[model samples]
Target: MASVLDAGPFFHGTVAALQAGDLLTAGYRSNYRPDIVMNHIYFTALVDGAGLAAELAAELVKGVAEPHVYEVEPTGPFENDPNVTDKKFPGNPTRSYRSVAPLRVVREIADWTRLTPEALQMWRERLSALSANPDARIIN
Candidate 1:
């Protein structure tokens, strides 16, 4: 069976917030929409070492899986403005796509490599084939 991963409730919260009049900007104080909510979902899955982004992409293409989602709100004071909030912003002032690629690789490799001998062998062959294709974009 194809594995399924859900991005969890945070994404739902973000969607609800958007529907409820809260703006969903890519970063703070900036208006940017995302290409897909699944990007964030795949990111979390990779971070938690659940699955590869490619697997997520495949599942997405197959229309048989749901990816993780997250809700982001103003977590800190306005940039360069001291009178913005009662407390200082504890983290980065601007939002960004956190570490995603490395974690995804970890999960994909782990999921396929750490297993029964049969799966390992299969993965080994796949890896060999992949290695032979030097033109393959490792990052993609």
Candidate 2:
């Protein structure tokens, strides 16, 4: 059996409009690295982290969606996300995880913090620079 890594009132951030009981699965294109399709569905224990993700996702897609954070429950096993765990933010400070199984949406978190205009611009520039570099990797 797969070991339990976290007992979470986990949250997923995205631009996709979803309701309670909606399932989020892998195989969707990544919000950070738009060039690749992610094999695992990513979530975080932090509400702000999820909000950040939702912001990036919404902005990166260029108005295709509005930011939304949803409380979620993983259907099966999950593991720490290497991209942000030891590799980027050591010791999982981000409290981020990924799973191949579907995540069930519990409800929308309506009050997560949204980025200020300056912060949003900073991220926009940062993402542009990261995508420009061939060395920038998403441990996919």
Best by TM-score: 2
Predictions: Cα RMSD each: 19.1, 1.3
Q: How do the residues 43-136 of candidate 1 rate in per-residue lDDT, one tens digit apiece? A: 2212222222223332323455433333322322212112112223443231222221112111112222123557545745665565567553
Question: Candidate 2 on 1-140: residue-level lDDT in tens?
Answer: 66767777899999999999999999988888888999999999999999999999998777677999999999988899999887876698889999999999999999899999999999889988989999988887
**TM-score of each prediction:** 0.25, 0.94
Best by lDDT: 2
TM-score, candidate number 2: 0.94
| Local error of candidate 1 at residue 118 (angstroms) | 0.3
